[model samples]
Target: MGADREGGARHRPVRAVAYATCGVVLLAGCASMPDTGDLRDVESTPRQDTQVRVFAMPPREDAGPGEIVQGFLEALTSDDPNYDTARKYLSAEAARKWDPERSTTVLANGPGTAEDNQTGGREDSGNLTYTLVGSRVATVDAQQAYSPAEGPYSRKVHLSRDPKSRQWRIDALPAGVVMGKSDFQRNYMSVNKYYFASNSPAVATGQSATVADPVFVRKRVDPMTQMVRSLLDGPTNWLGPVVRSSFPTGSALQKGVSSLTPDDQNKLIVPLNDRASRAGSGKCAEMATQLLFTMQNLTPAVDSVELQGPSGKRLCELNDDQAVKRPEYLYFLDGKHQMVRIAGATSTSAVPVPGALGTGDRELRSVAVSRDEHTAAGVSIDGKSLYVTELASGASLGDPVVQSHGATTDDRLTTPSWDSHGDLWVADRDRANPRLLLLEQGAGRPVEVQTPELSGRMRIKDVRVAADGVRIALVVEKDHKQSLLVGRIERDEKAGEQPVVTVRGQRSTTPGWEEVTAMSWAGDSRLVVVGREQGGVLQMRYVQVDGSAPDGLAPAALPGVKTIAASEDDRVPLVAYSDDGIVRLPSGGQWQTVVKEGSAPVYPG
Candidate 1:
């Protein structure tokens, strides 16, 4: 998948294009072709209903060409369902062909220069032009795909007169719709669709590792139903191989039931097609988990979920408390290099891991814990080899999961990161053969991860995978500068074949920093990076995964900070190795020394 690969968008017969007009010929050409995706045709009733409210759409039938454009521009911001009222400004024929579902160009302001909204056209025919100006902030496609599109924008609405009605309306325009940011914010909501981790074996243990695929949906328009549909549609291609859906391959909503609605008691009733009836009790419970976790953000929240078959026969039912919550297990390498964990957010004491590995003689340089915390993969102090040890018994599962290929002593293995599904991610920066590897939770052999975007000469300093399993954060050395980058993880799992993992879309998380020493995911969309400007002291700051600085003050500086770790839970505390030794930031508290000998600290991803 490319940069636009994971975007979820919707469009049937509609096409949209963001145009930069220059020559008149190119401007006309912009109206000729469809952009975004392939166009398909679908039919629906045309309504300018007053009862169904959405964006504001004021009357514009009596307005002039300029006034019509201005009126429509103002009406576009109203929360009138489906922009039906906005359609009233269009000629009936144009209204029939125009599809707001094609795309939406969100602007910083609803519409600009509408005051000077000029019109140009011939007097003999029904053709006319209206230019509505504004700054484009982002574009959200019909499939709910969003992308930043910062720049000035021009909506050149080509209007034509309906031969019978003789009223001007937007006829040949761009494929997608356009709206202001304020209106978009009020109407859309961010939601996470839950899916089981394909690499996890927890299903046998009563709960599977759940991954959340975040997306934005229309808030008031049966959001729960839309969320479920999107979940059933499956994760985006980048995440497809990493996640599994409980809903069967061919399963769908029952015919004529386009959405799930809550009963009087606020319990959601989801009617699935007959395919869902084939699922066993275990499968039904998994499906219920997916639904309940997905709809947890809705207003009042869903207390329970009841799956119904085609004829309304009960399939499975689960209460809110039954949903599987995201798991967390924190561990760190102490002064003695023993694998130990923090007891609680407020507790300073560390506990030894259950297995011999926790108390064994082998000194660990870095450690990564599986979601189930049953096993851990650690890089030995020399960084020559990686070892997998059992947490309960201290028995060596694999003496050398992988060994270094680089020439020098500094060519070492980076800290390991474990995905929720139990796969371990680590980079062997041996200059001779620097490689990224993924260790299957229970399997011995390691799978090499390839990212063509990474420079061949670059050395991997650290690797951190997000709990969601869809993203990874990397500390790398290139051209002698240590940089921080985040990438989307994609996998190709073929039947009876070993799965191949690839990281393609690598993005900088600290674009302006000259060097990055340590980094970890602080939340789903944020990261804590220890960075410094050229010749400057290292400062630990909370930066968005997108590379923007979080609002307010940066987290208290970590003077002499060497390695850092933060919990996946945003509200959880942070820990780091500073000059003062193993120091940790308690929840809303100042940094305190947790262990004098601690070095590498990490929480379950």
Candidate 2:
């Protein structure tokens, strides 16, 4: 909606008060407060030029109706050049009608006999109140009761008089037709179309044409302009009034609209309903999806192994003794943690390293796993091209998709997640703060997701998908304070309301843990977090489905856990690190070191 404009419609302010009350659910981004519109007074007349009424008074205490009427006629048809001669003989009512200009013209043409009075025929049959303005003069109100086109029009005129001098004068009025307030309102409101063609020829009988007002033209063309315009136009039309009344008037929608006509009421409610429907439709539903994961290494891996979480089994391992050394490789695993496939396994220049090397960086710099555990995506540490491969066919989906941010770029990609559509959502933490980028199929530009609350002030440590593809998770760092935020991406098309997009923080159960590093979906609802304690102990924590803290949910004995993933059944989680190796922990807290390689493994969710 647009704002209210001046001169078009007048708006009156109504009394209202409001205070913000944040809810348990994310509500910080609520926009659009109520605005009130009051009725304005109307003052416009119909005729530009018209005659005035003249009343005449008599000398007697009680004058006959005919005598009073005759005096009024003589005053209206006065023939004195200066009007002084005529005014001297007028009774209080007659003097009021004697105009000097009219008298000059009448005298120039010479005064007529009594038969000339019969031409217009002045009548005074009813009792009309004559106010005494002076000792000898009194004046009665007059209505110009006749018109050339539409005869017998109603008009009210004020009369002035001098009682002592017995002088009277008729009031001057503008000439031509004029419309009243009711007429104007009826003409505007009764039409379906806001405006009709002013000068152009009309369209065909059944055709409709949009008027070409400059303001209207700008609104339809400029996306943001329309919103700003609505803001300005609200006071004049429905925008401001509806918003003020429906939202903050301390009145409910029904109650606030009760005073408006049925048509006006519908004008307000219909658009509001449409806005809510669009917001709801844009929200994601409950569903699972698979994402691809790939990482770059200073030294590439010579072997890849997959472990099945169910029954604590090893599924498959791929080993290449003399294969080409690849710079980075993205890996995908099945529900059983078996190696699905690795994409971007090509030659690189880095020297080989088998054991843990602080310099090697071999654990997949960028990775994204599909919800269904089928498709995977990976990018190198540098913001280079993205590699996506389907696990089922062991085939590359297409050529790598290049994504670069800065002028001088790194040959690496960033961590990519999946929105509901299984499209890739990645963040480049290489900048001042992590920036979000959405890559969709058949689209020329990636959707840039940057919020003022997150972009410059908060740094993104990790981006992950919830079990439900629609929910997004981010480990954001701001002011040295680390927090986990969960939110559904929502957009608000209406300018009057707040942008529906928002991110709310979750409760942290791990005490003294300043920041969270990674997250893996434990189920369709639950999520597991890897956090560093203030004492520098790497601990595993579980966050509930909702954004509540996972107090008392971390295991007491697990150590050096660099990464963690959930089992297919969600009954146990797999953890890996440089010291404790790969340990498996059941939901009941039983633990076992399943591997000693220290390869950072993600869950097969």
Candidate 3:
């Protein structure tokens, strides 16, 4: 009913450690033990013809190995095409070689394929050549496998001695071939085929068979015997199918099924109902949900899913299961509309209301969003405090604030804004000494800017810190008249002696720009201001640093918009707040809808 609990690797066998030295002691030890599962002996024949003949025996029958090898070399390299002429000097057994099956000549090269100057072709050679570095047992090497298209080639040969004749020869050459999984498996199984062919009759007759190559047997099949021994010696209940299923299979799917852990594969083929019957409610629900979700996505059992409230009322229906798994995150709505968290199969247990923002316990000081929705600012609640916790994860960052007497009390603290260099700036809103605090990169207290000329009779409505954090702009009521004041901060070692300058417009300013609700840097040189007048209509205006004011960019229809967020590239303004839903405005000649009002937009950083 449930998954099996045991598993084992496929056909792993015990192997003997091979030593490089082949002395009497090694041979004696190898002779005493017969390695299991090797069947390569069927292909080895001691009686096979093993002589190499030449057109003439060299003058040095006992010549040094080098001189004897040179004679064989001359025979093969004398002609443009070496095969026919080279075959003439070979012994009857070697000369009669012909592979009608195409297997032996799979990589052989033909005429005009050898690039030797004796061959009449400019193209690259495509033949593998074994150089006769003298006869006897001096050395064996290969010339490059020539290719017509490529000019260069290199090769190495496998040299071996004939066991029966006790003579040396270049018996094998390296094959530059890569086998696919099927081919490898097929060839791998052939070793077993020969083993069984040689041993089955001996086992049936109750007689011992001569051992095959000890090196090959121990290298390959002995490990499977060990694996079988381990499985048989362990607990029998769980190991049966695990051992049996660990073999190569008919197809990839079958192989994949075979390859899984015994438990997982059993879980796959076993009935889910049976497994669930024994599971506790919690475990059952978890498993069932995963299975149901997987099946719902992969199969066509259900048409759609309707999320209902506890009262049996439908909340939201999703045609796509993919959408249900990741419902849009709604951040700009209040309790009356958007549901922040949902619980259970039904959606009745929704939690978290909008506007009632969580500021990570008492750690966050202040928070503010720009009217244009392009910028947001926050600082610590107390003037003495420096860093505040991020509302989402409680991470901390240093924020600058204008120290006011009542900053520690219930007095409203201004939200600190960030500039391009990650500096924070906020105004001392409650004090008679209302000054601008410019937070910089030093280790001590913040540097303050006080301009009595800019502070008198001024009730700051909105304050904006520019991208440099060195520039401060504000909409203040000075002398009972609303005015726009732009100033630069003079940094110094002291706490509050820096001077500020008011930038004058071309007309020396008419009435000074008024009703500025929020401000942010629109570009390197421009500032966007979101504000409203007596009519309660919202207006977004862009102005240069040197200018007084400019015309509105967005229409006056958005009266309830409060906060704005900008795209990473600053190409769009997402105006969002918690009242009716969420709203996004892309910066274009005309506004177009990207995210609907009711669905929350997951802000990607």
Predicted structure 2: lDDT: 0.33
> Which candidate leads the pack in TM-score?
1
Candidate 3 weakest ten by summed lDDT: 1-10
lDDT of 2 by residue, 1-605 (tens): 01111111101111111112222121111111111121111122121111221122322333332233223324323211233433433444544653432111101111111212222322231222221111111011111111012122222222233445333332322122123322221111100011121112223332121110111111111212222222212221211111111111121112222221112211111112122222221120100000000000000111221212223333222222222222132233222223323222221112211111111232234445554445566554344655555544335345555455543343123457654344566666555334666555312355566455555667665666542233456767777767666544433335553223333323232334576766665533346777776657556666543332322345546655555655322333334442655456644556665544434455432
lDDT of 3 at 241: 19
Clashes of each: 27, 64, 20
- Model 1 reaches what TM-score against the true structure? 0.74
Instruction: Residues 552-584, candidate 3: write the lDDT tens digits.
Output: 243224445454433212333444442434454
Error of 3 at 281 (Å): 73
Best by lDDT: 1
lDDT of 1 at 548: 37
TM-score of each: 0.74, 0.36, 0.32
RMSD of 1: 10.1
